[model samples]
Target: MKTLLSLSIGALLAGSSLLSTSALAATHAPYTHTQFSITESVQPADILVVLVPENAGELRLAGWDRASRNHINRAIEVAGFDGKAGAQLEIVAPVGLSYGRLLLLGTGNPADLTRAKAETMGASLSTWVNGTKAESIHVNSQLIANAADNHRISAALAHGVELRNYRFDRYKSQPEARPSQRYSWQVALATDARSKFEQKQALAQGVFTARELTNLPGSDGYPEAFANYAKTVLEPLGVEVTILGPEEVKALGMGALYGVSQGSHMKAHLLVARWRGHDDAQPIALVGKGNSFDTGGYNLKTQAASILRMHTDKAGGAAVVGAVKALAGQKAPVHVVGVVPLSINMISGDAYLPGDVVTAGDGTTIEVGNTDAEGRLILADGIWYAREHLNARVIADIATLTGAKVGALGSAYSAIFTQDAAIEQSLRQAGELVQERVWPMPLDGYDGIVRSRIADKINTGSPGAQAGAIFLQHFAADTPWVHIDMAGEAFVSSASGIHPEGSTGHGVRLLTEWAKLYQAKQD
Candidate 1:
């Protein structure tokens, strides 16, 4: 009932090739370009992108000559473009340009350049440039001096542009009435680090896959459906895929996950996808909480507003499926085992009550303080699956776990819970590089919070995030693990930057980069 969306893998060049006078190519463009069009390959560019950094007084047009620089500056002043970050000025028929139009892109400061900004700039470029009919546009990243920085910045920019060019109009009844994907055009971007483009493209594909899966309605993307998607896509890309049915999960003592699904019509599942890039090393474990739909079971979110957006509750599982797709497709030199426990927390005649006690995969009893707090129960089983079945050495689990986390961080960061130094540091570095930021919170001091009179632990407490993480820690035992609460960051209410108006695909980039970091350190 679901279809895999087409992904574009643009042409990659080794270095900058000479452009004719009509092409408006930069002399110092160090990167060889990849020719990619957002739509089909038949279109041509409508504009050209040139970046200018802001200095003390005037804009620093490093690559442009004096005459063209003055003309661009005059146009900026006339258009009130202050070279501010995300500011733009359009010029028609400038003094020295190959294309008829010019886009004055801004970088606040040269020294403060980051991958996040690069991605934003790239998205800004697509949002503005793709608004026009120009099919092919070029990016000039010549001003950046460091070859590696140039490569990262330029590739991130292109990746951003590619990300923003997405649309999920599958369920629209009047699909034709819905806006066609117009923010898609051919893009010619240059970067000296050619491999970075391949990697970034792979990462973008992962993000896109996650977004698409999350965007699907609950009726189309139940637990079994998601498992099928993994095998359909990842298996073809050389990833080993496994789907554990409710009986299989129950037989393995995944009581916590099974309890959450007993109320729903669809049976629960534990899906695993493995990429064995390095046979000699143990694969890093990635776990996701895949609650296809959270009706809150007995403690239901009866409010219309809360129930409407419950379809996105499975973002964490969608991300695991996506990351493996990218890594396997790219043939990344890393080993990864992605685990996702899929279930729908719905209300029914047999729905588990709020006060019900259940034993988990690790044989620990849990008092279900609130059925709405069900993400952690599934993740508990997932963590146990990673350790007992996969023999995980390092694990990271992502979920839309706690409303408290969103209240604390808004939509900016995922609340990270871990006590491991190396894993925490690597996650932080990866978050910064890819901009899916993780803010570490405490793992201890939760013993008294989730304490129950009868059961070993209760599911909810005053501080929901800490208690949820602590509950999961019981299953992880002594393994190095990190719990990421992505309640706010995984889905959005409006279009912004690289994210469209819906599913944000928040954890894909961070996990992909972290896998790369782990692979690098181990090798």
Candidate 2:
């Protein structure tokens, strides 16, 4: 019986592993490769030929085959090697041949190969190779450099590919199972640039760590669990982590947050993570609404099917965690604090209802107009807590807050509402740099929509649907704050760039880049 029980437990563990394969993959050891020199005397069977394209001549030669004494038209034609931006072509040959297959990747305008672009290209290559079944991939260096820095170009390209091939799929029962039927390819880089490529790989790992947290599931990513995860990921890097539970939150009169938690069975929490890279500088605080599962409470959601995915409502909080994770991983010299207000919004007899007046942490009474407008309530408490307690100089809060943002900005860019033009510009600049676009939204006429007759303010507009973003702006309360309404971009129905269909991990990259920029300014 004991043996049987052990076997059962093992099976359960295996099953759990399968369920969290992606999560496990997030921290997997990165693939490493030694660089090799490019040779003109090459056969057609190399898996990934890295060639230096000094001019159009080198580009033409990359298509040539020494064995056949002609351009490899068959491989080019059959493999679909179009030299367009972000496109790749793969050719498979017999196992005994020089490299077994050839991969032709597009690098647009060889002259414009900056390190960033090269890294992106390498990541794209890695992403492509990861999908294939090749056991070995070779990169020809002759097709990728300017005479000024041949070694740097080679290393950058390899670094990009290595970073791109990264996947966080460790929790699966079959660890080797591929989404597609492609085999894992071994990459060979130009020998001289291997060290530089390794450094870039480390940076990519840090970036990937941040991205994974943003993409995590809410079931396993509860407030306390997230706080613990942060401690695990950052404590080793010297960041300080503090978790404020229900008792402490209530003691502090964080009514806005507590009111929302009243409906949840799970206790609400506020996680504060501090990283003091500078001795005497005021820290930038990132506050996020970590609603684990938002059901709209007594103002119950009519869209049952859609609301089922409300677990992703914590995307904003995840972004904050993700940014801090990246910053810590990179050992970035920046003073920052991440404040996450975590809870779930459910319908219960004890839940705060419409027309109810609740005093916030700041002692401002808010009349609850709609239970669905719970994000702002929690955020109100969090933002105030950050300013009054943490003594933050700049505050930014991100939330999958309102459907009105979707109606306004769609799913591409988040609607950014900020009182400070400088903060708005910085966020916009960061968003643009990372491709996580944000559009500045006006707050001028939003106050009228949330003004309350029965109390200091209403949770939402009386009209019930329109101008929700504008209504949410009132909760910021004159702080130098930026509210990112990520309702549209938090989750999506399709895939893009580095994101899959479900949670886009939308704000992670945006906030990380913004934090970096903010840190640079401080320095």
Candidate 3:
């Protein structure tokens, strides 16, 4: 377990409302790292892994001696292990090898081994290795026929291993201890994949940070704490962070956001974090809805299951900061701005009630049909601020905003709403590559869903998910924008794939990859 180290230091900037600092330090729980060495030779280890492709005729064992190959062949013949993807075979005390164990990991087809598939294979490998007590392992990466493809596949596998190792045990009374001894990980490849692997490591770091923040209980996960985290984690990496407390938020005329904050004794805040890897390039904005803990305001949630995990509502904000951390950590040449509006929608005497209308930062009026629909209210002002004040070239707001989205897409995909076909296509491609996939939802006919008789727009509408998208789209105006309703994708009910049974950290990779692609196109 790790905690924030406190210091009696404070500063004020940007007016009476902006509080910014770089001296704060918040340490996260220590993450595990396997001591990996890239090499051309397969060193002797307790466990030796041979890569077996489905096309056995095309398989090429780079460093295996004749004797070792004969023994492996005999084992393969005996076990009837044709190299199908996800198939595994193990032999203990092999005939010609002194190793304690020999394992064969299957690659479906060398030609079909994409980065996504490689990551899946790596995840499976992590699980298999964790079940064993081996102290070291050697992996052979010579199964693929193409050298460039081999390097990329190997790097993606290493990334998968790192991602699967993430565990959130901060509050566990006796957290399960991982294997104490430092495990030695050696990989034999024709070309060095260390640089590629390190880039993936940077992404994993961002994902880990996003997961940790989302897993924290509402008691510890608050607006101030998140701001402190950004200052501590991102500022050192050269990102500029600014924290706007309740006063600042109200002073900026973000009435819709301020209305939602009145419900909680704990005030709301707006956090602005910017990472500028290029001086003159226009920055893209990543706006995340930071509802630290939502009690549905006056329209309280009746079921325990619905309210038990509301702390994860802040997952979107965590991912935005995480993506920025990743881009800045690698010093990627892109300018990105992150706008997160942090608030807790708890019931109180002063809480904004249903049917109330409030003006947003951009002077648009919003009627609160259902106080439970608070995410879009805060995001409304967040998007407006990003576009009007920050001068962002494109705006993408991600949130676990609607339950209707879950019914529409389920746990497999997130729902994205955008008018621009290019933005939609780019986001989908990025999501597919990173495995945080997005499917487009209709935004045209849904405009009527948010049309309010009493205000500029209604926060809640008939088709819940599309209504939320259209509500935020009003704030985005004519800018290239996308509204990602990740209600189904942010947190998982069960562990699967590379994600554990908790916050998936879904948007961090998607946003980071999209930003990379967007910047490349700009050049």
* TM-scores for all predictions: 0.85, 0.79, 0.91
| Per-model CA lDDT versus the true structure | 0.75, 0.63, 0.78
- Candidate 1 regions exceeding 4 Å error are 1-44, 53-73, 76-87, 95-98, 108-111, 143-146, 174-192
> Over the stretch 1-523, how does candidate 1's per-residue lDDT look in tens digits?
2111223442211111223312212122211122452321222235656665664255444445788878877877778776566667889877775667888777656557778887888888877765665656655555555555655666777788777766665445564322122222222223225457667787776776788678766766778877776666666568899899999999998889999999877889999999998784567999998998888888879799888888899999988877887787678888899999999998888788899998888898999999999999899989998998899888899998988998888778889999988788888999988888889999776568888988998899878788888888878898888898998777878889988789988888888888888778777
TM-score of candidate 3 on Cα atoms, chains taken together: 0.91
Arranged by lDDT with the best first, the candidates are 3, 1, 2
Clashes of each: 10, 41, 0
Better of 1 and 3 by TM-score: 3
lDDT per residue as tens, model 3, 349-453? 899999999999998988899899999999999999999999999999999999999998896788999988878888998998888899999988654788889
lDDT of 3 at 386: 95
What TM-score would you give candidate 1 relative to the actual structure? Answer: 0.85
Positional deviation of residue 235's Cα in model 2 after best superposition, in angstroms:
1.7
lDDT of 2 by residue, 54-89 (tens): 222323443345543133444555655555544566
Candidate numbers, best TM-score first, in rank order: 3, 1, 2
Span of ten consecutive residues with least summed lDDT in model 2? 4-13
| Model with the higher lDDT, candidate 2 or 3 | 3
**RMSD in order of candidates:** 9.5, 8.2, 6.5
